[model samples]
Target: MTEHSEHGTQFVSKKYTSWPAMTEDINGGTLHAAFILAPLAMVMAREGDVPVKIVHLGHRDGTAIVVRKDSPYESFADLRGTEMAIPHRYANQRILIEKLKEDFGFGDDEITLIDFNPPEMPAALEAGQFESYIVGEPFAAKAEVDGFGRVLYFTKDIWPKFISCVLIVTQELIDTDPELVAELVQGISASGKWLDEGDERLMAGVHREGHIPVDPGRGAQVIIPDGFGTSPRMQAAMIASQRQYYNQDPELLKWVLSRPPDRVRYTELALARDEMEEIQRYAERLGFFSRRPVTAEDPFGFDDYCDPSFAESGRRPLPLQPADGQ
Candidate 1:
């Protein structure tokens, strides 16, 4: 429960804290960077506040839209003008929410932003809390298994093929613990590789033993909700699919980079992962990489990492404007 101010950002050692502990302190590793160590981190930079030295855990498996099995509303189109349930304040939901507002002209005021949180979304939907719910994973699968409803549309259908949601730690940790950060990042990248190549039994073992509480086979990860691989191609497609959300022409991505409310780079990490080794080499080509002296030796080589001595400087949020003439 310690907080220090470093370099205009509230430097919290907690950002590097372990899983259960991180989540307990700040809404469950729901906001922790340690969980995700690589590639997925680049995708989350789509949002403005993400740190530059982020370690992505993985991508969202996909999204699912559903109504009560017997609800009068039967299709994704029915979501228009109908109240959709969601857990507000989750970083993962931000893009989806913005996309919904852009694609369907639905705004926060138009739909019910349920306070029940993600875990409760399916149950709330089944209980008639709303006409439909925006959900992910085992919860969605559980709804169908219980005969509550079926998938009306999915992220693959409405959004992009590959979407990344990241887990990030403060630069303080990267600066304070470079060696540790590298280990964590390597773990993540390796974990993804392992998940992709490992046998089903191993995957099942991983799912059962890892952070997520649900059984991957309980119609969760098994139903395609938990993706095991890090598909770089999917990232491009996701960004493309998301253009409509920002009112950017889909074709514009070819001629220009994405214009976002955030600068679309490392704003969240204290040290910026693109400054790391193999990751920087792979990511910088995509423009997510940085030109800083990146070395794999220690992620926390920076003197300012985790010191939090200057955080009270009151930094302003990054200014983000729609790319030239959206």
Candidate 2:
């Protein structure tokens, strides 16, 4: 989704479905800003080649740990020496997993860590490849709805007000057009407001009516996984096609609708400076900055990476405008 500022500034936004593509776009100058995972951004920044700074947070507290619905495991304590998968070492999921281990008095060897792409996680779990997988939704939600897994814990339950994704910009963009960056943040914040309202379906995209393929054998009980990673503009049509997947079972619908919204101010999008500091400490603890170690005391001259001044002007409300051709 995109929004225009009253200054007659037009913003065009695009979605990159994968991390590599998103990071490539940011580093290659194809896009000026992005909603990216926080730790990964920190890693890129410390590596010194991808000069991007996190200006605002995109989301928070929307991660979970999932296990097969029929599994005997009950908690982190029950999964001793079991196979576990996380998206990557740089992901917040790994930190939480470590915290889980420490809290439960489990040794590092008690959990066999495996890295799996988010989409592959469900299938891997279903096939018993791993006992549990931790990732961000709608993947976790996808597993539950498909009846293959159930949530063991939500990161929100463990780490209150946890910060995850963030909005970042290339250093060049920040230097060349700070106002434009502010405008973009304002636009995204407004979009978040619309999304937070929760019934407008603006976040869900355009729907078109027609017959969509569903398995005849499953009858009306077929669960189509069409819109899992769909862009907002396409989610309407994608969701429309997958109605049975969402509506066939009231309990599942309740669960899907029950996923909590990320905690965001909506009107003023700014980096959670305190949380970012915590992330920096965790990254260092996890050895992400081993080459150029960033500690709490000597955070390696990284304090300048966070600049909240843009947010000062960026938080201003956008003047409502008519939709195109209205």
Candidate 3:
């Protein structure tokens, strides 16, 4: 592994074109950790026996339901008899759609839901392959910015604090090197706080050199070596990097960021039992737990699969200075 940080731990970033490919690697132990879909993570741990634990969340409420700008679909009622694309059957976006159907007094058969790769959804929608698409950013943002689509609703408007993806680590890593896990959780928390701080910080992150000032008291610091969007050359590099890393478009990313502050959130990410239970309830109702039956009384073990200690530790205030003249 390449040494990417001052700390002894080496980091390797991998990209996957599809979730199943990524999940397969996680199951086979080729990948140690991932930011994975929440419902899929639960299914992996409980049903697929992947022996992983949900440590933290990636982001909240970054999803939307979009329809063609020229289309006459204004309400959920208008979606009847139309086809919609989703990232996957197990995605929370799909669950959100299901919840919409229920709340609107519509049956499952009223609207057709098809599984399509998120990167393809915008082009597919443009070509009239589907009436609408629901997905996480910046794919949904792409359609809107490209002028072919308009938002039907942002998920936050319906499900406050909606969780789509989570940070998951293998049981082996938790057992063998917990300090690393703690450090990772803290870093994620800090990064999320930085992102949610406001536009200035967000723009700095995008336009300036990437580095985390060493917490002198802590003895080691995390470093992002790439200087993205720092200049014309780096801006092009950043765009290419985002495309490779997330299949993301720069315009869409800017659009997502320029929206209301609450369009998507990164703070308040600590894993909560109530939230997990709510997700489980939805997953169960949607028949996502096919390998085994689950219920509120005897649900797939959230207590066993989720470890909030790392997030709890991450939230504790760091020391202001080095202790006793290290």
Candidate 4:
């Protein structure tokens, strides 16, 4: 129930379970900055659905689609009409589904969607509740280790190097206290850098001691490098795909598109308006926005969201000593 303040010396928060739950917490004024799916955060920030903006990329290139080990499916086309599990409609997994439909003619009705939190996906797949699932790391790696599932697609292969999670905060925080936001961003960036370290044994040992009891090798398999930045390409990829996922409502798009860009603030990065615009144009060519939400206001124009003072002043993560006596 604690909220961050401009003058507070510490940042404390109650843990949330899922993306939707985390979104709700931030919207309900419980949390300040959160590690969230990039697309969902942008979608929520659009049209002021939530008073938040993305500040930094938390992690990148860590999602995969997993199919049961014994299943005969070899590609997206082969999995038509099968049951699949996803973390949520707002997750990057939905973009993969859309890509399948675009490339291989898979119908929305062809594959059944089963909703499960990422943590529960492995057990559900092993129990035969679904034939396949798409989720972020650890869960996918767990399935591989437990011998119940095999990776079929890594989303990076489909999109040109996209981001998965991002750090977000309320617009009020950015408006009021820029220093606090910078500190938070630096902390998250350093953590991601630490996670991206080459020392697998240390990371694996920490993983083993922390939550899951898996071996170092298994832990290494799930760990992926998370590049931190405010790359316009990353923003465009997330926004364009999200717009397509929620293409059912033209009015919603219109409302979102007409809204002025929020003043986004960052530490070391600035908004890449041109790259995002180019991405939007390309996405339009690919039929991402068949409805054409707003012709005037560009959703990718995040100048309002661009305040990189914090990012510029903050420090990145440095290498740490080896763990587990490595």
Candidate 5:
């Protein structure tokens, strides 16, 4: 009953509480497509013998490092010798922590890194089990909303354009139904654009309501009742989608919305060789690629494991501009 047919194609969505379980399903061919940690996906394809390829990205700059608000840790340097938790060893959050250690000139034994489920991190930190934890949002926002954690750094601020997850499909699916894969990529690309643009418009409306000031850098214009002025259909569709996909706790949603426009971005999701190379380099440096040695010339078999054509050719949905005279 998880499968629903749309436009003659059956779509199934599966949720997993842990990356290892999801990765197992992905490797076993139970899941055709998923959004997973970028480094983990690369390791899965190259080291774990899964025939999957990265087609598009999930989002950018959505991860953060959080410490208890009452903790004495004012900076990353203060966390030296303290235990820190990460969702997974293969996660980019782990790589970011390694980078932080390098940047702060800390040794390997300086900070103890533990693997803990992201959802349990906030509670553990509150109980003094760890000094800090880094993971993707909604979780970080959860901590802030509960008034227990304060952000030490948003990945966006430190890594700039940090990619946590990517959309990957099995190679079998790609070879058997290339058109379906193309449709999937294009649909995701368009939706990502739509979400980014709609967020801008929504933020503008929030600004007009005196809730928050619109950032001039984002070029958001003041709009009326619906973020898209005079476009009731667009407004209705956005509302419905939010109700379905983003139906999280009200306080969590509010905390997410109160963040700056660029806290997380959905645009620029197309897979780029340079970005992939960067992740591979970090993964190699961090010893995530244990199955085989990676060389500077070609790491992780990038060309064989990635197909950017789908994302490059994907059509973007046009934003609904405000109509003249209201």
Candidate 6:
């Protein structure tokens, strides 16, 4: 291992660095990462920036609503008309909460959206503060194990389960460090594999010092894909639903896909019209829009969020990329 500063080290042979301590440099530097509320939101937000490879840690596979195992509402069907609470706005919890309502033909108006952060939802739910709120893995697992609530459903089952919690970079990083990026991709796969195998002791030494949220048992539930790459098949659905997110206006999926993963799958919306319609109407229920418009307010929404484009001759994927040894 090659040490950079006394604080950070570089696996120089791999062309990346192991961020010794999670610091401001990680988020503010090329090592920047985001805690995602919605996995698909990640898909929509990172649509256009390609040269930059993204890192999908495969942890944060998403969450679901769990009620006390003995609750009257046995399943999602029971959630109808029931006042359900969730943590904050525009997160996976909020998104999936509304999704359940919409799937049942109820819109945002039908159910209540409550706002609270972590520990609050679990702590409150255990005390019966609210019917149910969105919760993540381990905690979701822990809640069920602790006799808090029976799972309403695991949200990942609701969709294709796009990888969430991505590590992103600027196009400039990729332009100057394509080889470095490639090696980092390999290292991500390596770390993902290590995370999977549980080679490091559980809370013994370095792994515990590493700020890892997962235990050996829970690590199995966490996903660590080889790279930040996304399946093309998911792009269509990701783009369509993202357009309705109301965060930044929707962008043209094409403009975003102009430079995507060098290799990926593709599915056209015409075939997915029914599903798209359901999502659009779901958004409407949340007051996202009264109706789905044929075109978006920002037809070029994808390209609009660039810090500075390192436009290359070919595709540039900016999904997520972790540090070399991290």
The sequence of per-residue lDDT tens digits that candidate 1 reaches over residues 1-326 is: 00111122222223222223433433322343443323334333322243444444334334466777776665444566677765333333444555566676665566655534555777777777778766544345557666777777665556543233444665545566655555444443443443233223222211221344443232212111134222222222223334222222323322121222111121222333233333334343434324343346523222322222222222232111122311
Q: Per-candidate TM vs. native? A: 0.47, 0.75, 0.82, 0.64, 0.80, 0.49
Which 10 consecutive residues of model 2 have the lowest summed lDDT?
215-224
Q: Which 10 consecutive residues of model 6 have the lowest summed lDDT?
A: 262-271
lDDT of 5 by residue, 1-326 (tens): 01111133434445678898998887777787988999988887787656888999988997889999988888899998999999899998998899999999999999999999988888998999989999897788778889998899988899999999999888989889987787778766765666665433332222222334334333223323324332222332233224334445544644553476567777899898898988888988888877777777745567866888887665634333333212
| Runs in model 3 lying further than 4 Å from the true structure | 1-10, 198-244, 295-299, 315-326
lDDT of 3: 0.74
Better of 4 and 6 by lDDT: 4
Residue-pair clashes per prediction, in order, are 32, 1, 0, 17, 0, 21
Residue 200, model 1: lDDT of 31
On TM-score, who's better, 1 or 5? 5
Predicted candidate 4 versus true structure: per-residue lDDT over 143-192, tens digit per residue: 87677888887665666345556678888888788878987777655544
Which scores better on TM-score, 1 or 4? 4
Top of the candidates by lDDT: 3
How do the candidates rank by lDDT, highest first? 3, 5, 2, 4, 1, 6
lDDT by residue for model 6 (1-326), tens: 11111222233221121122222333345443322333232333334223323332324334556687667987677766666666445344565665566677886566676766554566678887777776554344446555556666665466444222334444566667655544444444433333333232221111212344454321111122233222321222132223222122122222222222211112110112233334434433454322322246533222322221222222222222233323
Per-residue CA lDDT of candidate 3, range 152-192, in tens? 98989999999999999999899989988887777667656
**Model 2: CA > 4 A from native:** 3-13, 197-257, 260-269, 295-298, 316-326
TM-score winner between candidates 1 and 6: 6
lDDT of each: 0.40, 0.65, 0.74, 0.56, 0.73, 0.40
